[model samples]
Target: MSSENDWNEDLFDCTNDCGTCFYGFCCAPCLFGSNAEKISEKNCCLMCCLYLVLSGVYLCWVPHYFERQKLREKYKLKSNPSCGDCPTTLLCSPCALCQEAREISSRENVRRIDFNGDNNQPVVSQPEATSDEVNHVDMRV
Candidate 1:
């Protein structure tokens, strides 16, 4: 899991994957919708429609902020305290969408390739052994 204070991928590192950048540039609505759906675990088409309709707001990034925050937490990345999203999402929505898409795509691909591949088991930590579970011995000779 990534826990950096910055994004797992650079905001303008679209050149890392040109396909995602092109997709975001060609159809921002779909990119945002899919990202919302992934973060919210809801219907992609429905989220897409809602995002498209609500995008006219000057502060449309409000909704996306929540979703992007969720993605950051899900990937264990540190939250942005600089309030940079106001520009990353509001002024450059396409680039933001591209970054989000790349993050999800990279995380999903890594998950798929982990532990013999296709094995998506959660790695839970076991509790420490307790005194009750320990064996006791007598020192009698």
Candidate 2:
């Protein structure tokens, strides 16, 4: 059974290929004992231990973090006219028009929306609206 200090030492050694190292020399004995082969496969070390600890912490705290991120993003509103500038705002949302526009923008067939062109419009389409909503319709006609 290796101690944490021994695992740390083994992990820091550049000579060993992590893929081939055994859990007994790489991970804490208690953790290795429960899942020896699995730990050995991953070459578990101080970094892996830290990653697991951090992931556990993240799992416990992610919901709150995500909620805060949502609020922050909402408050930090901007008229980002470029898909490249605001990828998260464009991609994550459930807007069909935005999805289609993204698809079009990706294609070589479609003309690129030049950011510095006379009309600095985003390639993304306007949000969908009901039949009565004329504001949603493009005025190109």
TM-score winner among the candidates? Answer: 1
Name the runs in model 1 displaced over 4 angstroms: 1-6, 80-83, 116-141
Model 2, 1-141: lDDT tens digits are 422111111112323433323332343222322232221233435434543464454441232223223332433422224432234322332121122222222332334554545677665667878765665465644
> 1-141, model 1: which lDDT tens digit per residue?
544755667788999999899988897778888888777686788767767778776655776777777887777776557646666677777888898999888778767643433565555567976665553323232
Model-by-model lDDT, in order? 0.76, 0.32
TM-score of each: 0.69, 0.16
What TM value does model 1 have? 0.69
Inter-residue clash pairs, candidate 2: none
Question: Among all windows of ten consecutive residues in candidate 1, which has the lowest summed lDDT?
Answer: 132-141
Model 1: clashing residue pairs? none
